[model samples]
Target chain A: MPKEYDTFVDDLSTLPEGKELILAIRDLAPGNRKYDTRVVKAILASSANKLPEGDILWLRYQRGSLRPEPWRIKIIDEREGLLLKEKVYDT
Target chain B: MPFRDNREYIEALEKAGEVVRVAQEVDWDLEAGAIIRRSYELKLPAPFFQKIKGYPKGFRMFGGPLANFRRLAIAMDMPADSHPGAILDEYHKRAQHPIKPVIVKDGPCKENVRIGDQVDLYELPAPMVHDGDGGRYISTWHFVLTKDMDSDWVNWGMYRQMIHNSRDMGGLFLPTQDIGVMYYRKYEANNIPMPFATAIGPDPISALASCASYGVGRNEADLAGGIRRAPVELIKCETSDILVPAHAEIIIEGEVLPYKRVDEGPFGEYTGYRSSPRMPRPVYRVKAITFRNDPILTVANMGVPLDDADICLSVCGRTDIKTILDNYGFPITGIHLPPECSGHMIVVAVQAKYTNIASHIANAIWGTKLPYPYIVVVDSDVDPYNITEVLHAIVTKCHPVRGIRAQEFAVGHPLLPFLSLEERMWGKGAAVLLDCTWPLDWPKEIAIPRKASFKEIYPKEIQEKVLNNWKNYGYK
Candidate 1:
């Protein structure tokens, strides 16, 4: 339901096929921030539209708050290193 | 009779203090789902979200509508304090009479409409349930309406659905399910798109009726009416001829395209685990959307025990099994599929009429629609709903060797985690039957041992005296 999700989905859909890899990180703290289940699910869902036939590394963190960085996604193109990276969304 | 619609059902829940109205803003992203999950875990009242973070003021959502037996009792129009077994008995009795649904011109679901280019599922607040799920699940607790191609049979079932952009939705449609069989054998076989309609937040009985494991060709609408003890009012879908509950809060009319598939699943399931990995599944192409002015999206936050799916399956599955055994002259007193077992096990209490009756009961169950793996048969004196009583029978009366019968290569459910990869893919696994009833051949005096329960060990006069003076002698 967030604007960032739509933007991410668009980026994934338009990517060049078989050229990029993705690294998705989600924060799963023990406290209220544990609500990041949606962040994990949404990332997996957005990855469904990925045109690139590359590996996806899903990582979970226990860092207590700064929960602002609940989820981060980085697109890595073999030669370009990091292509598109988003570190923080609406907290 | 059950409540007329979700509004009436909610009122009953509210009066009984079984639901909480959440007035604060809650994010549909994962926060809303997290609260629902916690509610189920704690056996708390249902949560009605009056204010969602991004949605309109009136677009509400409900979480864990049937989280406990008390709510289920209210859903069935019984006292909120009724026992679990009593509720199950009431449901089983209602299932015996299938009243037909009546058609109506228009209803609350049609108060607002979105058609053609106006349809956008993302506009609704379908929450992302679990962290590792596929996407925002739009149809967790709703019943999908699909009719038979060559007959008048219409099936209503709750199949988990995920959003695939705007007009497209992906969901599980296993070839073994009723809708799957109809689509695979008839619609897809004939190369035709299967017309469908989905109703969210219908009457309490109707929503549960959709999830029941009834036989094919028997309409769920009729079963819902039977449960309500009154005819369910239905209205025609805008794009398709399919009928949906007139009082439904929201309705989406669509078609399942022939030979089309989309990425679905990895969502939280009733099995208390994340469902199957993301893979291509059948897609439903939305044609129209209809709803009330302030529609309430019913969310079935599946996972863990005592959730809506658990309550529905326990009561509905119990009736299905009990009916089958009764028809075969098994003399069953009760049959329960504990929501805790997540549909993998069933406990049956039966009077021993002859020798080795457990195998016949297992065979009868395997032939039915939903064949579970672990079946436990206890004496009629034992209450299947009481897990303590069931476990006692199993540990004491049942012989370690003679009572447990394991059947290799038996029928199975595809979602069970214990099955091998091959078995999960093909629905083949080992099943067992545990006979806890005393053998009829055992002599009355010496061979059969006496139970240590209060009813069996205490004298009638002493029991009466204890009960009569319990409060006077330091009890609460």
Candidate 2:
């Protein structure tokens, strides 16, 4: 099967530049997610290296919904600026 | 205990850690509006801009002066952390006693005076409060003072005024409003210019009193004096016979000429909508401008809830409704007009002794001077201040078909966005009454269900334990 969408890439810079990204942070986080581009750009410009494993970053160009349902992601493992993870679903 | 003037109120706010000063250069254009809007959204302290971009250092603009309950409490001379209900109770208790004002020879407002050609309206840093506003408004928080031709009754009213040029401004003067339009009609009959004086920053309590629903031919200055429990000091205006607060920060003396109309409005009103269109209205000709050195301009930022207008108007509405209901001998427990509704919704809690008691109170409210169109009558058990409890009462006790009543034709506020074109134009609207109380004639065997609540369901000891351990359970 194609690499699962939950699989995290190494450095955030390694991900395809134009692909959509989604932030799975708490509801009380500062800054609005409606302007996804600015949020992604700010994240990339930060000093953090590896993506939190299982975190899904949806780029603006890829999403159709203005405000999508909130998604939860959990980090599994990190090695050499890379993150490997899996999505957890409730039964 | 009452503030003598606006300066005293500002100093009190500053001492209470409720004033924020900005020294950076800011534009009087959209930038100032945006900053004030953001501050209000954040529920921060009142902002005082000391350095407007084009204006000099002495000139200042204050935004969201009474945004927080703590600030309002201080302005009313109550303890800083007093509850809103207590403040209203105090105001109502004081309003019953009327104290007349004392006129003095001179005060700080006369430190500098400009008359004739020296008068310039553009010198003051009036801000464009919203992007879609028609123009910069200068008299958002101030009161326009006018007197009747045949009587000595002086009226203080809050009306929006737009700056048009160096010496002239335009404003809306609805004929139904007590002071401006009514006075203009009397002047029109005699064919004379109606003398008027506007005070920019007077004592905060006096400004609050202007928003009350006192009947026509009653002097608001006297009512303000009653509320303050001390006589207000009045001084003569330069160009008119009108009297203004002696200690006001700035005063503008002028006249409203009969048969003269100019274009005004599209300004965002307290209804949270820019519903009013630009149309021809009365023009105010400026004859004299008086102020203290480096006077501060107070602006009420409109278009959103929890602003100065919402707080003051709601307090005034609650006090007036309570006093009216008490005079009628209705068993009233509480009255409240939530700020978020912008004076459109009124909630009354009462102990109903008869079947139609709720309906009677609602109809009486409709007949009052308050302009709210939606009213909710809840039983004494429900807390009028708690929106969730009121909603629960409506959902559980009210029957959709039997408990609701509607008055097809009632006086509607023109600024309400939901009104039709005809209703807005004619100033006529409908009123709805929601009776959220149980039927008194229900069978005794079919007992009313008890409310399922923590205090109702749990044992007394358990409830007391939970309450005492609330902080320990990490429920801040």
- TM-score chain B for all models: 0.96, 0.95
DockQ of each: 0.06, 0.01
Overall local distance difference test of candidate 2: 0.73
User: Which of the numbered candidates is closest to the native, going by highest lDDT?
Assistant: 1
User: What 10-residue stretch in candidate 1 chain B is worst by lDDT?
Assistant: B273-282
Error of 1 at B139 (Å): 0.7
Fnat: each model in turn: 0.00, 0.00
Q: Would you list the C-alpha lDDT of every candidate in the order shown?
A: 0.76, 0.73
Tens-place lDDT per residue, model 2, B179-236, is 6445555886677888889998888888888888777888888889988889899999
Q: Candidate 1, residues B1-476: lDDT per residue as tens digits?
A: 56778888888899999889999999888889999999888888889999877788899999988878899888888888998988888998999999999999979999999998999886788888877576678888789999999999999999877876567777876666889888988998899999999998898888888878787888988899999899999999999889899999999989987777644556778888763544456778899999998999999898878798888888888888888788888888888987787777899888888888877888788777675888999999998888888888899988899999988877654466677745664667678898898989989788998887778888999889988999999997
Each prediction's total of clashing residue pairs, residues at least 3 apart in sequence or on different chains, is: 2, 8
